[model samples]
Every structure is written in C-alpha cells, then in structure tokens.
Target chain A: MLKVENLHAGYGGAEVLNGVNLEVKAGTVVALIGANGAGKTTTMRAISGMVRPSKGRVLVEDLPVEGLAASRIARLGLAHSPEGRKVFGPLSVEDNLLLGAYRHLPHFLGFRSKAAADLKKVYDLFPRLEERREQLSGTLSGGEQQMLAIGRALMAQPKVVLLDEPSMGLAPVIVQEVFSIIRRLKEAGITLLLVEQFAKSALEVADYAYVMERGKIAVAGTPEELRKDERVLAAYLG
Target chain B: MDTSVIIQIVVSGAFMGLVYALVAYGFQLTFATSKTINFGQGELVMLSAFFSLTLTRLGAPYWLMVPGGLLFGALLGLFVERAAVRLALEQKSEGWILLTIILGLLGFSSAENIWGRDDHPFPTPISSDPIHVVGVDITPLEISVAVGVLGIMGLIELFKRRTLLGKAFEAVSADRDAAELMGISSTRTVMLSYALSGAVAALAGILVAPITTVGPTMASALILKAFSVAVVAGLESGFGVVVVGLFLGGLENLASLYLGSGWREAPGLLLLILALALRPNGIFGKASIRKV
Candidate 1:
C-alpha cells in the first residue's frame, strides 16, 4: 500500500535518511526497528511528508506523494501518529479524535453526528477513552495519552497508519497494554508501519520486519525469519 | 471629591478603553495562530477608518459603509500576511517584524497621500448627546463603542468554541504539526486569523472614529494604549484584554484629571513596564514549560 524508494531527507544540510527503501503492503503490520539515530522515525516522517525528502520517491497506492505538504498527504488517506504523542494539550479528548477525521467530516456543524460511527469503534477499542472523552487530553496519564494517540490515528479511518513509538516512556505494564492493543489492530486487519524501540514486542506483532542501521535497511524478512537471524538476535533481541 | 465626578470620569474612560481592548484583540487573533502580530496594526486602523470615511463621502449609507470598510480591511490583512508574514514564516525568520512595520509605514504614507493629513469628523447615526444615568452623563456614542467591542468579541468566542472549523483553528494554535497531520492547514488558519484581525481593526476604526476623528495620526495614541493592554493582559486571553483595557483607560483618565493632561499617557506606560517586569508572561498567561 505504501512504498519508499531510496528516500533521502534531512534537516538543513545534514542528511539523516540516505538511500533507505521499504514497503508496507495492504492489511499487514510492518515493524521498523533500529537503534538510536538509525533514521527509523525520519523514514516514517519522509513517507508521511512531515519531512520533505531531498531525493527519491514515496508512493501511496502507487501515487507519487513525495514533496507534498503533510496535510495534503494526510488528506490522501495517510494518518501519522507522530512521535511523543503530540495531542492538542488544551483540547478535549473527543475533539482530538474528531480532528483525526478532519478530512472526511463537515468543517462547521453536525460533525459529532457525522463522526459517530468512527468514534464508537474507537471507544470500543479503548473504553477508557469514552470515560474521559470530555477531559483535556494533556491531563491524561502517559498510558492513556498513548491510547489517545492511537485512538486518534484510528479515528481517521485511513488506508495506512504510521505509528512511531507507541511504547516510548511508558511503565512496563502500560507497555504490555499498548502491544496488546497493537495485536488487536493487527487482528482487525489494519495496515500499519510501526517504528518501535522494543524489538521483541514489535517482532511478535509484525507480519514482516525491517532492521535498520546507519540510515539503511540492514535486513528484511518475515518476523519468523528475523527471529532466527543470528545477527538480529544478537543486536536487537539481546 | 464628589463620588459622582469620579464615576463620570471612570465611565467615559472605560468606554474609550474598550477601543483599546478591540485593537488588542486584533493582535491576539493573529498571534494565536502564527505567533506573530502585525506591527503596522495602527496603520491598518487608520487606513480602514479612512476607507470607511471615503465610503461615507461617496454617499453610501452608514450601514452599507460598515461592511464595505470591513471587507476592505480583511483584504488588506490578507495582503499583509501574503506580502509580509508568509515568506518570513516559511523561512523560519523573524523578518516579519521589520516587514510588517515597513508595510505599516507604506500604509501611513498612502493614507496621507490619498486622504490628506488633516483630521476629519467621522459622521455617525449614533448620537453624541449625553443621557444622565444616576449623576453621570453617558453619551450614546460611547455606549455604541462598548456594544460593538463586546458584541464582536462574543461572536468570535462563540465561533471558536462551537464550530468544527473553529476547533481546527484552536488545534492549529495548540500544535501546528499535529494539526497539519490531521489535514488542517496552518497557513490557512494563519490567513483566517489575519483576516479576522483586519476586520477587527476596521471595526475599531469605525466604532471609535466618531469620538476620536479620522486622521493618519489618530491611531498612533490609540495603538500605543492597545499595545499596553495586549502586553498587560497577555495575548492569549480575550477576556483579559477587556478587563485590563478598562482598568488602564480609567486609570489614565484619573491621572489626567488629577495630575494634569501630561500624565494622561503615563498610566498605560507604567502598567506596561510593570507587567513586563513583574509578570512577563502576563497575569493571565500560563507559564510555558518547554519539554526537552
């Protein structure tokens, strides 16, 4: 559903993503695992148009989307739950989810009724969100915020979702809860490109995995194949 | 001192203060979305008033002239954003400060060239005759200023709180990147704000033009006081500006009455310096904690 061909992107003159290539086919979870500064997040950003690629192509459903504005890319059915759960701090939780479906809903009135079905599905996935729908999102705890972030992304009903670090800065128990949510999503057949620090958890949920190092994909295989690779086991699994 | 005299002074000054609040609200509007305000807002006020006067002189009815002036103001605002703010913002440069100021200077010269430098009396259907309330005489023109200021502010606040597009506006203000991810364009939001701000500047010009007269230099003093209100109230709070604007207005009038007309501008300056020294974030502004 999404493909990146030799994408090169960076801040200023310093290139962070150099000749990186990957793909996420429809209805499968693709995990991107890498050590710090391996360009995993930048890869996701490049694909989502958050960072403009200096060179190469990003295709969404075979349409070239590289160098497009981020909002334009989103309107074309790509939802990126950016790093650090950057929810609108002052807005109500329900408003955050409604904005996820911004492209589909009406701009002024009756948006609530329009977004009812999507809101219901998201609430069913994370019941806690329903309980705190009216609360300011910034007041939510870390795990709750992560759930809000994921739930917000799902609200888009996008064809592809790029989830960056769903487990970052969470307690161990909360991390487990997040992964279980991911498992549920995979079972529900959502196409996702996940960038995660926890390789073991990511591999377990991923249909396919790409291990990145120094701005390039070092290995690519099925999760089972990645688990058996001695180098993958030594570097990531260890 | 007679208590009624004090009330009369406060009542008049408070109404004038509402004009400052209105212009300050204009600054708050653009600042909310783009973190940048038009330095030439005073010029915007003067030009819009001048435009409205021309509309009146062209034999347009007062009601017709108001919307015409507002439209002209919104277009001028869009011009300012496109010509000044957008490029600087895209480059992540602070050049907009200088650019907007230059544009304001351009506006000032244009107004002088087109309308001449002399102050002109702005005709209004609203009466200037004072009606006695308790022992204080209140002018219909002053009452109109309060109604206009509060009425527009109320409508905007309602729009922000109720509409989906308005929610998107707040979303951009809260986090530009996240809003962009949701397909809400920050550039457009900034444009809307500037347009609203320009409309607001026009409204202020129209509402106060009768009382202060329309001239190139009329907005200079008004803009200074508006700047003081925005600084003291914090750019984030709509209600804060009204309260602070009223307070500053009253204080300055009292200063002029007791300490002489030379002290008229002193209270606003003092309050501004005090707000800067003691509460840099403003009394209503929440301290921003930058998370690394």
Candidate 2:
C-alpha cells in the first residue's frame, strides 16, 4: 500500500500540491484525473520522491519515504514512468529496458538475473520493442516510444507503478492501446497510480478516481460512482 | 607566398583542428550528461601535459607516460567532478559554469607559477619526420594526433555501447527524472561523464603538448578552438564534432594562408555563427521536443 498524507509541494515558490491526500491500495488501480496544473503531476512527483513535500508524509508499505532520494524510494518498489517518454535516444531499445533495472547492477544482490528475466517479460509485453531491440530509441515512433516507456518501467518490477500523461501526444488509437496496457496491468493485480488529463478515458479504466482542481482534490470515488456524479461529469468527464 | 608554405599552413591548420575536436569532445560528454559545462577543461589538458613532462623529465620511460598521463588525468577528472560539478548540482544552478571557469583560472594561473609558464619543448613519442601525403609534408605528430583523437572516439563509443555504466550515463542524460524512477543514480552518472571529460581533455592535452608547447597557457588556444568546434557541431554529435573540428582547422589554415593569419579565428567563429543561425540545433545535434 502507498499513502500520501497532508502533502504540500511546489516548484520555486508556487505550491502545486496543497494538503493533498491519496492512496493506492495493494492490487488496485487508482487514477488521478485533473485539469491542467491541478497538481496531478506534482502529486505524483511527491509520491515518487522527485519533489520533497514542504509538509507531509509518504508511506510506502508504511515505511517513511517522504524526503528520501528517488532511487532510495524506488528500492522500496515504487517506480514512475514519467510524462514525455524519457527514453535514452542514443541507446538501443533493449538498452533502454536494461536501464530500468539499474539499481540491480554492481551488487547483483540476486537481482541481475531477475532483472534480465523481467526485461524479457517486457519484450513479451511489447513485441514491437523486441523486433526493434537494436534500433536507437530516439528514432522510434511516438506510439512505439510510449510503449518503450511503459516497457522500461515494467523492467523495474515495481510494486506500485505511476504513469504521468502516458496518453499525451500519442494518436487516439495508440492512446487506446496504451490505456489497454494499463487495464492489463490492473488485471495482472499490479497497484497503479495514473495521472491523466484525459479524465473520461482515465476514469473509465480507474477502479478508484480522484478529480483535482487548483492543487487540491475536488472529488473522489469508485469509477462507477464518479461516472454518475454530476460535478465530476460536468467538470472532469467532459 | 610559395605554394608549399601555403600547403604547409593549410595542412597543419587542419591537423590542429582535429586536436581541437578532441578537446571539444570532452565538453560534449559533460554537457550531454548533466547539461553542466566544465570551463576548467583546458586547464585539465594543461595539467596532464605537465604530468607527462614531469614524468618524462624524471627519466620514466616514454612508454610509461601514456598510461601515466591517462591515470593522472582520470584522477584530476574525478576531483573536478566532485569539487566543481557537485557544487553546481547542489545549488541547482548552471551558474556553477562560472565556478568551473574560476577553477580553470585558478588552476592555470597556479600551474603558471609552478611550471614558470615558459615555453618548454616537449618530446614527441612518435617521429617528427615529415611524410608526404598527397604532396603535403605531414609529421608523425599530426598523424599521432589524428590517431589519438580517433582512438578516444572509438573508446567512448565502446563505453556507451558495451559497458553497463555507459548506458547508465545515457539513461541519466536522456531524462534524469525517468532515470531516477528506474533507480539510476544521477550523481554517479554525472561523475562518470565528468571523469571521462577530464580524461578526454587530458588526452587532448598530452597529444597537443608536443605539437604546441608545454606551458601554463599551453591549452588555451586548444580550449578556445574546442569551444568553437563544439558550438559548430551542435554540442551533441561526438563524431560530428571531430569532423567539424578538422574542417574548421583546415579552413582556418587555408584562410590564414590566402587572406592573413588575422582571418584564422574569423572563419571558425564565422562558421559557428552561421551554423547557429541556420540550424540552432547544431550540425550534428538533434532538437529535443517535449511531448506536452
């Protein structure tokens, strides 16, 4: 389980996440849907230890990870597949997947072979990646790049996976494909925290959803509950 | 002017440019990894040269100096990464670019005090005897430089391809936030890049020392030339940098002979300006586009 309580975060002096509360229960998919700058990304950053909360606590399996470095937090099995598909352009598609298992290298700790096996599993998930395994990632099409991004994250074998705007800039068909992958992850019993601007699509797949506005949560519920809510429909589902 | 003299200047200028590309390649490494520029790079070269000279002067076999220079260079590189690069990362300021420049100034000036800043002839390990290639007299020094820089390029390629750490460097450079999510340590990657930068600078320093001079200001021209080369090459393409480095080098030499020596800096700088104006991304650099 992951918990963020009373979280406060910002860039420079402008607060982006204020007293925000959220959680992803084990084996559940929680989609955080919001307007632009509604603190969805900021909230994810805080949870993944990318940004330190000015005030709050982040508990990973009840372990304090609020102010820890991201790598440290990642060891606790929380991995974020960031917005904008930040795959290494010059490296091969295969190498990009390998990098997602970086913490396993240099000490093995029985993780090297495990990471290798997990990487092969990622290749299975995205066979196009395996076909273009030797090609430089930078040259991949946007849809392929998004697939590569999710594939790379899965290589980490994370306990809780965070996706920020995976559907951004991708084609409608590709977006549907990516959301299908998210849906599949939930089917596989993985805990997921997804932040998306495409609220309607996100809530459709989200088991539990939160609608954020101006750096705070406006509403929260199960997918069915939020789907029927008038405010959620008017403000976010549109 | 005689044809041979013009040819000599042109050939030498081009060869010198290859050396400049070698130095600039160092800058490209750090810039790619962390987006932090190490202004002290020139001093790193100069210091390496002095290390080589001191070792040779101490009667250490010339063969020992190669690895000796590289080892010493690597240490200096590790030091710079820790002391200078770390400061910039901690402050979250690219402003530490000035810190590296200051480090270079302090380093170069202190070296001047220690080594007296006098022009000292360096013994070239390879033959200085001229060999004619295409009716042009080229020394073993130029050939060695061409080989040395090319070797460095090959090695860096291998590092990025074959090594686990090199991929880590690439991961960090591609997207630091995403890299962290993958559990990649940014500090380690940046340190690795800087160390490689220092070594590259040292490689350039050691090779150019014999051709130019072993002095406190030994690498100043080399550093400036590298800056120009990197600017023209778009600061991204490593091999592209080497090609541009050689081209500008040759162009400068040709310009100096046909027009005047004063026009030497003019062409390289002009090329840099023209490149930026036409393709701000650089001759070899690809533009980065944000998804959102």
Candidate 3:
C-alpha cells in the first residue's frame, strides 16, 4: 500500500536517510525498528512529505508523493502520527479527531454529523477518549494522549498510516496497553507502517520487520526469521 | 462639575477606544495564525476608508458602500500577504517586518496621489446630534462606532467557535505541523487570517472615519493607541483588548480634560510602557505552558 524507494533526505549539509528502501503491503503492519538517530522518524517524515526528500520516490497506493507539502500528502490518503504526539494542545479531543478527517469532510458546517460513524468507531476503540471528548488534549495523561494520537490518525480513514514511536515516553503498563490497541487495529485489518524503539513489542505484532542501523535497513524478514538472526538477537533482543 | 459631563466625556472617549480595540484585534488575528502581523495594517485602514468614501461619492448608498469597502480591504490584505508576508515566511526570515512596512509606505503614497493629502469628511446617515440616555447625552454617531466594533468582533468570534473551518483555524494556531498532518493547509489558513484581519481594519476605518475624518495621516495616531491596546491587553485575548481599550480611552479624555489637551496621547503611551514593564505577557494572556 505504501512504498519508499532509494530515498535520500537530510537537514542542511549532513545526510540522515541515505538510500533507504522499505514497503508496507495492504492490510499489513510493517515495523521499522532501530536505535536512536537511525533515520526511522526521518524516513516516516520523508514518506509523509514533512521533510522533502533529496532524491527518491514515495508511492502511496502507487501514486508518487515525494516533494509535496505535508498537508498535500495527507490529502492523498496518508496519515502520519508523528513523534511525540503532536496533538493540537488547546483543541478538544473530538475536534482533534474531526480535523483528522479534514480532507474528506465538509470544511465549515455539518462536519460533525458527517463524521459520526468514524468518530463512533474511534470512541469504541478508546472509550477513555469519549469520556474526555470535550477536554483539551494537552490536559490528558501520556497514555491517553497516545491513544488520542492514534485515534486521531484513524479518523483520517487513510489508505495507510505511519505511526512513529507509539511508546516513546510511557510506563511499561501503558506501553502494554498501547500494544494491545495495536493488536486490535491489526486484527481490524488496518494497513500500518510503524516505527518504534521497543523492538520486542514491535516484532510481536509486525507482519514483516526491518531492523534499521545508521539510516539503512540492515536486516529484513518475518518475525520468526528475525528472531533467529544472530545480529538481530544480539543488538536488539539481547 | 456636573456628574453627567464627566460621564459624557468618558463615554465619548470609550467609543473612540473601541476603534483601537478593533484594529488591535486585527493584529491578534494574524498573530494567532502565522506569528506575523502586517506592519502595513494601519494603511489598510486608511485605504479602505478612502475607498469606501470614493464608493459613497460614486453614487453607492451607505449600506452598499460598507460591504464594498470591506471586500476591497480583504483583497488588499491578500495582496499584502502575497506581496510581502508569504515570501519572508517561506524563507523563515524576519524579512516580513521590513517588507510590510515598505508596503505601508507605498500604500501611503498611493493614497496621497489618488485622493490627495487633505483630510475628507466621511458622510454618514447617522445623526451627530446627542441623544439623552439615563441623564447623559450621547451621539448616534458615537453609538454606531460601539455597535460596529462589538458587532464584527462578535461575528468573527462566533465563526471561530462554530465552524469547522474556524476549528481548523484554531488547530493551525495551536500546532501548525499537527494541523498540516490533518490535511488543514496552514498556508491557506494564514491567508484566511490576513483576509479577516483586513476586513476588520477596514471596518475600523469606516466606523471612525466620520469622527476622525479620512486622511493618510489619521491612521498614525490611531495605530499608536491600537498598538498600546494590543500590548497592554496581550495579543491573545479578544475581550482583553476591549476592556483595555475602554479604560485607556477613558483615561485619555480624563487626562486631557484636567491636564491640558496635549495630554490626550499621554495615557496610552504611559499604559503601554507600564504594561511592557510589569506584565509583558499581558494581564489577560496566560503564560504558555507546554509539556515537552
């Protein structure tokens, strides 16, 4: 459903993502697991058009979307829940989700009623969010904010979602809750490209996984194949 | 000293202050979206008023001229954004500060050349004769200023709260990147803000033109007080500008009455300095608290 080919991108003079290639097929969860500064987030950004790629092709459903503005890329059916849950801090939770569907919904009036079904689905997935629907997103706890972030991305009803760091700063228990939600989303057949610091949690749910080392994909395989690799076992799992 | 006389002075001063609040509100509108404001906004007011006056002279009725002026103002605002702000913002530079000022200077010259340098009276159907209300005399013209200022403010505030596009506007203001992720174009939102701000500035020009007269230099004195109001009230709060505007206006008239007419501009400047020294964030503005 989404593909990045020979992508190169960086800030200023230094290059961060060099010749990185990755793919996520329809209705599958692909994990990009890497250490700090491995270009995982940068790769997600490049795919979503937040950071323009210096050279390469990014295809969302086989449509090239490399050099467009972030908002333009989003309109092409790609939702990116970026690093550090960048929720509209002052907006209400429901408003955040409503905005997620901005590309499809009416711009002015009757948007709420139009997005009712999608909103209901999201509310069912995270009932806590429904409870705090009117509260500002900034006031929510870290776990709730993460849930809001994912729920917000789902509101877009995008063809593919790029989730970066779903468990970056959270307690182990909250992280577990997050993974369980991911499991639910996977079972619901949502296509996802996930970037994570926690390799073990990511590997358990991923259909295919890539271990990134210094901005390049060092290894790619199924979860079982990855578990048997000595380097993957030593550097990440061990 | 008759108590009603004092009431009359304060009421008239407060009416003038509302014009400052409206222009200051224009500043807040653009600041909320792009963190940049048109330094040429004062010229926007002058030009729109001049244009509206021309509309009146061209056989358009007062009702027709108002909307015509507002439309012209919004277009001029878009022009300022395209001509000055958008480029500087794209490069992430403070070049807009100089660019907008230059645009204002250009606007000033254009107005002088087109309409001449002399001040012209802006005709209104409303009576200048004072109406007795609760033992105090007030002019319908003055009352029109208050109504026009508060009315537009209320409508814009309503739009921000009740519409999806308005919510998108707030979203961009809150987090431009996150808003972009939602498919809300920040560039378009910024453009919309400039347009709305332009409309507002034009309204200020129309409402106050009758009292102050339409001229290239009228905005200079008005813009200074508006700046003081925006600073003292903070750039974030809409209601803050009105309250501060009314207080400053009342103070100015009272000062001029007691301390001599030269003191008319003194209170606004003093309050601006005081607000800057004691409360830089403004009395109503909350200290921005964001968790990393």
TM-score of chain A of each: 0.99, 0.95, 0.99
Give a tens-digit lDDT track for model 2, residues A22-103: 8889999899987888889889888888887898989888988998888788877888888787888878898888887776
| DockQ values, each candidate | 0.87, 0.46, 0.88
Q: Please, what are the lDDT tens digits per residue for candidate 2 over residues B1-292?
A: 6888877787788788888988888888888878887888889999999988999899888789878998888788888888777877877877667778888898888888888969898886688899988888999888888898899889897777666677777778877777788887788778888888888888888888887889998887678778888988887888888788878888888887778878877886788788779888788888767655
What candidate 2 gets wrong by more than 4 Å, as runs, is: A34-36, A89-91, A105-116, A134-141, A169-173, A197-207, A211-214, A217-238, B1-9, B82-85, B89-94, B131-138, B255-266, B273-280, B287-292
lDDT of 1 by residue, B198-287 (tens): 999999999999998999998999999999999999989999999999998899899999999999999999999999999987888878
lDDT of each: 0.94, 0.84, 0.94
Recovered share of real interface contacts in candidate 1: 0.80
Task: Kindly report the docking quality category of candidate 1.
Answer: high
- Lowest-sum lDDT 10-residue window in model 3 chain A: A10-19
How much is A10 displaced in model 2, in angstroms?
Answer: 1.5
lDDT of 2: 0.84
How high is each candidate's TM-score?
Answer: 0.99, 0.87, 0.99
Candidate 3 lDDT, B1-292, residue by residue in tens: 7888888899889999999999999999999999999989999999999999999999999999999999999999999999999999989999999999999999999999999999999999999999999987789999999999999999999998888899999999999988999999999999999999999999999999999999999899899999999999999999999999999898899999999999999999999999999999888888767656
Q: Point out the higher-scoring one by TM-score: 1 or 2.
A: 1
